[model samples]
Target: MPPSLLLQHAPCARPTAKRTASLFSAAVLASKDGGGARPPRPRPRGKPRFSRQSAIRKSFQQEQVVFSTPVSPDPTVAVIGGGASGLACASALAARGVRSVVFDTGMHGLGGRMATRAVDDERQLVFDHAAQFFTASDERFQKLVEEWVERGLVREWRGSIGELEAGGHFRPIHSSTPRYIGVNGMRPLADAMLPENDLIKVIRPSWISKLEPFNGLWRLFENEKPRGQYDAIVIAHNGKCANRLLSTSGLPQLTKQMKRLELSSVWALLAAFEGPFPIPHNNSYGTFEGAFVRGVDSLSWMANNTRKLFPFETDRPECWTFFSTASYGRRNKVPQENIPNATAEKVQREMLGGVELALGLSKGSLQLPFYTRVQLWGAALPMNTPGVPCIFDPQGRAGICGDWLTGSSIEAAVLSGISLGDHVADYFASCGERPEEFAIGLDDSLNRVEGHDIGQFPGLDSSQKPQVAEAQLTATI
Candidate 1:
């Protein structure tokens, strides 16, 4: 079947796998055998209430460039990190007939945390090691997610999202907010949103090692070579990397804000079993494609990727992804010392041990994972997110956007970009050599989402992330 063709038989996620898997009745049935109900936790507050609907048709006719050159009339915006925030910013700029170049460090593809990997032994088995699923709570995000759903780029995951309490017990928490995921994997969703347009250009495996201010423009140095000159620079990276670059930009306030910002680290582990699921679900917690554990030592989240995404019953191994709690990640995150499998051994054991205790699986009963991989995500999650939708310093000609600016989750990341784009657009137009008319530039139409108190300017709602473990990774720049 074409990867884009939707599956009509998947059990957990409403959308069928874009590349692998089929029906997951067996997995869902097994989970149903051990199900229980739990109460919902109250939501957190103090997030920037997001509300905006700006539309700008593509109008720029100039050719796209890999590295910025002298382009009259059109200004260049360099966006670091080709993840959700970066792409969203580029896309928004493209719609406004603006020019932008995206620089990414990932060799695999654009999506940073929305990543996927194949098990070494089994080519068919795959896992989304970083971001698992996302929810749409804002109107702007809801509209975009709807379009993605219609385009087959995204699907709804009706995983019985539940909370794991103390002592390995589980409880199901009901919610109207539907969680969505990329069809094949998370990366494809971000990739699909970015089209090969004249307004937006992309460069991969290009890491910006230094950021220097040249006169009124910004010059980027990638791999120790002078890359290009950009009229404006958007820090779309996770806080740590962005903070590092901003420190050299000579923007004291912005650099200080990003530097003081703290983030949570995460150790993501992907494992594949020999055959169909080797573990059974416990009835007390209920069956969930994604689940989170609270008060559990070192363990944070676990997912049945095959069942949650592809849902096929092939003799091939089933895949699962595990994440360590922020606390555990901080304690164990250390530089590699050239010893092969040293970091892998300890992380893998810690994850597996958490799984064993959570499932009550005896060492022998629970088969060992045939395939395993460990990824260190430092500054993975934002701890204290700023209440502003984005940071736009006109004097600095630099702006900041990410989940951290808005709130964790894909929705927040996208919203942050859009909001930042609006600010950049207004600033760009007002200072241009000749004023150009824009479709809508934050005039009433960009009013705050109803009931949100973001002070005169509209900002993202502090729509708190209710479930961190299964809901996905958190952060922004």
Candidate 2:
């Protein structure tokens, strides 16, 4: 039998595109035929028949503009995160001939919430504590995911997934969209996205406490020590640390937008069991790889990490991850670095019991895991978004990108980072010249961008909508 998990209540403590243009060809053919009779009309004086437009519209500038520049140009960027967004941004910039230095506080590795933890005990249990799997709805992102799949960084997760209700009713989620996961864990996907050149330098386990502007360049500092100076800065992170770093960076508008971002907390519990769960199943259903738990106060999600990574093997230790609802996290929040043992035990007990209840198992009926741990995601997911692809402050030479700017997913983070990186590269190539098209997420009156379901979550109520005031449109410059 597995070791019993101890429980005790103690004192509180301590985170699509479309195209047109076929009819014109048919009209040209009909004009030249004998049935049309008259000769084709002469072209207008000094006007070519198919002259393409030179000026780009402000709304479509980011997608349409392409500039050529050599790699390792004069301008260097400082990317302040090594997660999906930051690495993707660095990769995109490197492709455009710009150099970038990425700084992250991840001790184990990059990939922020795309995290995985392995218990070093003899069992050697592995768990993807944060993001389980991701799907690509945009064609641009689908192409990138396909590339990762071909390179062995990612593969399709064909395991069973569904919604687990509080009454122990399970409804399998069926969708045509393909779900992808990293070969080992979610972190390797970000590792593979990184470019293989020296133009993009990565510095990990480094916390950037502040940013100081000197000689028209941003100098980063870890506490009092100066890290380096760069021509531009890309803030690929958010939450309290980010707010503190930019509180006095002299970029008032950028700071204001950062402050407006609302983030939520969550609790993830990782448990390693001896065997498969006792839930009954049939030939039509394989082991559950993931689920979005509904109507449960204490838990929101659960994933079978062992099945997800090694579906064919049954001899390995069974690993599972349970995610608490945002509200439950709020009620039991504590500092991640210094979680009291009492608090940890309490959370572990409550979450495990919650899981048992969801599975309709009697209280304490399930076998205890050989190992267990609890983690607090102080700023887990974004509660609101600016509904933009990315944010860039051209004048201050600072930009921001993450899942918050677009949607809460790995794909959103990558796309946001790539967009900001490409725009900054273009700005540098043009020698500090930019049109209004480069200014995004700056106008207070800007309409929310489409395709993102901001402030919408399974457990979020309508009253929880982000309270951002709509203002008159004003020039960012």
Candidate 3:
């Protein structure tokens, strides 16, 4: 968002034309028609007449009065979505000395998709039923992760293995260098990036319905109510929300492109057990009766409610969350009513011989706890189509940045944000002054920079002298 200049005073006020003409005429003359000349009429009483000198002085003073121009205030950025991407953008803006605010529709304290749910009536246990985990592939991101680790905001999952079910083709488990998780859940990472109460403001249970650019400022509306205005806006949520807002602004071409994109939905189940889960704590994956599903190792994913950081504990044995693929979601006709938890439970029961067996216990082993919930992820993953730009730079003023812009991963989102942010910075620097409200196509700029490959720093490239395996390990990790 670009900064705005504020003008405290209105432009110089002008005098009425009648007043100006009267001052200029000074004296009124009477005309005699077809007869002898007539004498001048008396001027109106109580009205002061202006001398020629006074009139000239008044006009000169008016000409000399200068109207001050409004100077824009420092750019105040508004970020929509309290997810990782939104928080990251806010943090980046803050680091640049730009103030920002984040708005989310989720529960006041909860973060999007890194959501947690309670299972029992007593509200004893909770589980993270949204994003399982995230990975970082950039050095800058890694440094941020290190800080998170130091502050105990996150912890490494330690063990992550991918197995191909066919022919028992299992590759040796390659531990991710540092797969991070929130101390309480994945929400902490988002929370950490946001500013404290005084610095950054987070508005929850609020959703932006429209964004209108007016008089060099963006006005955000919530259900048609005027929220406020900002110098710039960052739409960090899914494409659907962004598209909806952009569509209302009468941008037909942008609306058409946004509508072309598709999204998928998922059904997740959160269950509590009376004893240790039957599956290994590390996690497992396979197709059960044609249903492509994943049974997460709650332990590896840090799904323990007993931890002090988590909301609930008590004597509950364990809590586990299961997820079904988008394909399965389509086939089962999962109704909107039975979102997330319910859908998760139904799928689990169908594949694993009823909910009781899925929890690795008898029907009467424990209370059913919480009802199932379903989460519909519109634009969950972007389908990579041929000829699609890695980043769509339609209007230089606005650019698309998200996991969908690059690839599906936390790293992709971060990389896309950084790239787009850099592009915007460069564009603004080149402009030298505030840009007019219009879309400037960057087709040529993108073409010129295309095909550039990222290179590793010196001493980091493989072509250099080989080092001891341990030394390499320390450096690489």
Q: For each candidate, C-alpha RMSD in Å?
A: 17.2, 18.6, 17.9
- Better-scoring candidate (lDDT), 1 or 2: 2
- Give the backbone clash total of model 2: 7
Q: Which stretches of candidate 2 lie over 4 Å from their true place?
A: 1-73, 280-286, 435-437, 444-477
Better of 2 and 3 by lDDT: 2
Ranking by TM-score: 2, 1, 3
Q: Write the per-residue lDDT of candidate 2 for residues 1-477, one digit (tens) a residue.
A: 001111111111000000001221222221122212123433236522211312212231121222211212245678999888898888787665555788999999988878888777776688888777777776667778888887888998878877676656676766667777888888777778776655567888899997765444566788866686566789999999998888867666677788887666777889998878877432335456776676677777788899899887788988998888767777898888899999999999999888887776788888999888888888876765777888887666788989778657787887898788778866665555443556778654323322211111222222222333110000000
Once all C-alphas are superposed, what RMSD does model 1 give against the true structure? Answer: 17.2
In candidate 3 the C-alpha lDDT for residue 164 amounts to: 21
- Tens-place lDDT per residue, model 3, 296-364, is 211111233333233344455456554444454445544554446655555655433333333344455
* Best candidate, TM-score: 2
Q: For candidate 1, what is the TM-score?
A: 0.74
lDDT of 1 by residue, 424-462 (tens): 766565553222232111111111111111001123223
Q: After superposition, how far is residue 274 of candidate 3 from its true place, in Å?
A: 1.1
Clashes in each model (backbone N, CA, C under 3 Å)? 14, 7, 17
TM-score to true structure, per model: 0.74, 0.78, 0.61
Model 3 residue 21 distance off true place after TM-score fit, in angstroms: 51
